[model samples]
Target chain A: MQPKRLSVLGVGLLGGSLGLAVKSVASDCRVIGYGHRRATLDAALALGAIDEGYDDPAAAVRDADLVVLCTPVSLLGEMLDRIAPFLADRAVVTDVGSTKASIVRLSEERHPGIRFVGSHPMAGSEKRGVQFAQSDLFRNAVCITTPTDATDREALEAVEGFWRGLGMRLKRCSPAEHDRLICDVSHLPHAIAAALVTMQEDAALDLVGKGFLDATRIAGGDGGLWRDIFLDNRQNLAAAIGRLRTSLDDLERLLTPESSEALRDWLDRAAERRQAALKP
Target chain B: MQPKRLSVLGVGLLGGSLGLAVKSVASDCRVIGYGHRRATLDAALALGAIDEGYDDPAAAVRDADLVVLCTPVSLLGEMLDRIAPFLADRAVVTDVGSTKASIVRLSEERHPGIRFVGSHPMAGSEKRGVQFAQSDLFRNAVCITTPTDATDREALEAVEGFWRGLGMRLKRCSPAEHDRLICDVSHLPHAIAAALVTMQEDAALDLVGKGFLDATRIAGGDGGLWRDIFLDNRQNLAAAIGRLRTSLDDLERLLTPESSEALRDWLDRAAERRQAALKP
Candidate 1:
């Protein structure tokens, strides 16, 4: 059941880190990488994240036991379309996409010859580059595998087994559910952090400290990538955004210009729940 | 003016940390502590945060050259009122209060018989209690001093020099300005972090990963304390909250569900800003 060759389709932070992590536990797993930019492929190879690099993605996936799409969310369908003919039968294709449902749907419908399993490792630093890749990045983190009606059980197990070998805990969920949960806790929080930072009226930001630094830290993340994600999971994101908006509205109502006793009460409750969640 | 004796009015996290921090730098400062509860005072002394514990307010402050109030924001003024008469005439007094204007006003109006300076150290951890107290916690953090018209130059200089010796970047501002700036950056974000965690629809949050944990980390902070802070600085917090509301509204407009491309563009801008800022 060992993968003879693993092709990392995009040699960015996620792809490079996955390759590095896989190499950490499995000494025999030979890694090959392909990226649109030659610099990234070279960088991944120089970083020792991959054993080899190829400009031609078709050639990269020609003999891989596992092929992973690690490009930006917007590039997934087209990447699948181009690689469809090159993919060997039963050579399971997977993705590290933030959104699952759309990626699963696109690969299932577009690339009939290849098996597609959707994967998302909930790990990575704020930095996004091949140079930021680390073997221990996914250590103790959860990597979700979302399989659909068209997904092969053997492919799902193989991807899950690979993730587990990388020292990650595997959690199986439906594509829609992954999108919903991640949107609620991850994607929506990023958008909210950005909006919150942009909302500050303090133009003279000389007084900012660690609290502002921590709260708005996520706001400074990649927006184009996030936008693709937000749009891809519009239904879930819209709901999450709505709930956050309502909470803001309620807080606003409590904190008018003149009176604000209620604001303290709400803050107290929010603080309590937030603290309680951290206790285990 | 070398202080022969120092009294810490509360034996909790801040009080104990202050005692320990000061004792490390000034060996002659006989640090004594007092708390309403006997257990807290005992714990502070047991942990070497103070040399001795006292039950009576007057007994704690009687002969001390410096007295510090480090209780809850709501309790500072009350504690000052109780210990005002026992303060040594030239004994410099200060309170580590988050909101400054009210505390400054209280010091000016109530503690005229003794010297009072309002100070705030921009450092804390989610951990609470005397057990969590550690010396050198304030190292390399900003410690703000808010002085009123009645503040003596020598007393201000003394406290400024004290904090500077401890490796804190000292800043001087009016109490109102201090509260406002903190609201815009520190307190406001803490409130938002708290609210966002509670507002999250992702129930059964045992699955939340590093992003959610990091993003909402401050939310799990002390609720009652935050409540007191919000109420104490109601006006400034209200303004800060207003600014956040407007920003969220703009984000909502940009994310109108009907326009997919527009949403993507907005997300693109946010991501770009985020990426640009994360560079160190």
Candidate 2:
């Protein structure tokens, strides 16, 4: 029951930082990182995120009590398929993936023998890789855990404890609910911001002001990661896109020459909505 | 010419802040503010952004050697017309409106007798009013000036000199060029963020990780003013939206099942582009 050793996959930003955070907070824990790139492994090693780095997933997960998947969302399923046989029966596998539904489904299929508890630590930066990684990135941030009925309660408890130990506030949700919730709060916004920036190439280039900077600060995020999120939570993302379009369309109507008063009223609601959203 | 006095119209964040900035660096210059709101006038007086406040547009501009319009783009022309009759013949009249083309056009048609130069200090926040005003807001920011053929060289020089005194980095461009540039850098991003955040009311309520926060932070801006910006620069805004959509579409394609290489390539490019853009 005591997880003395932890194995981290994809030692880039999320994985490297996770190793760094876990190793820093729990000094007794031995953290081993598995990186796809030699450069990434070296950087993570230099950063002291891990005692050592392994090039092979099988070699990395051999005796570790925990294996944390830190790769891209698109690679989550494949990672499980590849690392499944190497994992010990007692080893709990978790991921720092953005969406939960697909990861949960993949876990149920690919790692039936090993327990998987999907986690999303609400943290990070516009910067990527180990260099941008910080030990305290998840501190005071929300960490959601989605555990299916097939999940072992023991594994869930241990994952929750790890996140809590890393200074995260943990919440529990169903895989379906987590995906839908994340689509609204996380994924859909990326699509809207990206589309807005991409669509207005010339105008955006010419007149980027503080408002634009504030709006698209996240637009600079890795597009591939966001795109995977959108596709994974397609139904929820579509619904979110629809809701947002209504807001934009309403503004468009209010902007019509005859609707200045309506425009003012809409803005009041928007400002009110914005301030209200910021309260938490 | 020894300009003995100055006038500030609108008396909100930009106008009030400029009034204080102008007075702080040029101590001998007497500055007064004109605003429709009694509270704005009181706040401006309390903030010491103005020597006094005025209710009458004509009275405010009559004895002033400098007049800076700091209201919404929609009202700049009407305001110029209202104050033209009382503007000092030798005075330099300018504005801090977001979009320059429309305001400059307004100035050209409305005040042939008075010297009009258009300006936009590239700064601000969603939090407004005189209380949020600061004298140094203009001090290390870009001060954009839009000079037309009708613009007097001496008037432009005086405007530039005044802003320089406030410690601004002055940059000159045509009003159309200014609008075009801002569409890319400012207005488009706001539109995108706003739309993105609104996409999923429920999802946004749950997952809002730092990525979403960074992506949609500016979605919380003053909607009325932003709506005005969107309408005013519809053509450019539309173009920006288009470009962003293409980028999003391309990313979406890269995330689909068969494109792991493309996904990695996109993330690498995205990281590179963002890092490059972030560099000074």
Candidate 1: CAPRI quality band: acceptable
Off by over 4 Å in 1: A201-204, A250-280, B202-204, B256-280
The candidate that achieves the highest lDDT relative to the unseen native structure: 1
lDDT of 2 by residue, A42-145 (tens): 99999999888989998888889988899888898988888988888789999998889998987788667778999988886656788888888888888999
In candidate 2 the C-alpha lDDT for residue B237 amounts to 72
Please write out the lDDT profile of model 1 over residues A52-117, one tens digit for every residue.
898888878887889988898889888888778888776988888888888888777766557888
Task: Give chain A TM for each model in order.
Answer: 0.90, 0.92
lDDT of 1 by residue, B141-175 (tens): 78889988899888888878777776778888999
Q: Give the i-RMS of model 2 in Å.
A: 3.4
What are the candidates' interface root-mean-square deviations?
3.2, 3.4
Q: For model 1, state the Cα shift of residue B191 in Å.
A: 1.8
Looking at model 2 chain A, which ten-residue stretch has the lowest summed lDDT?
A198-207
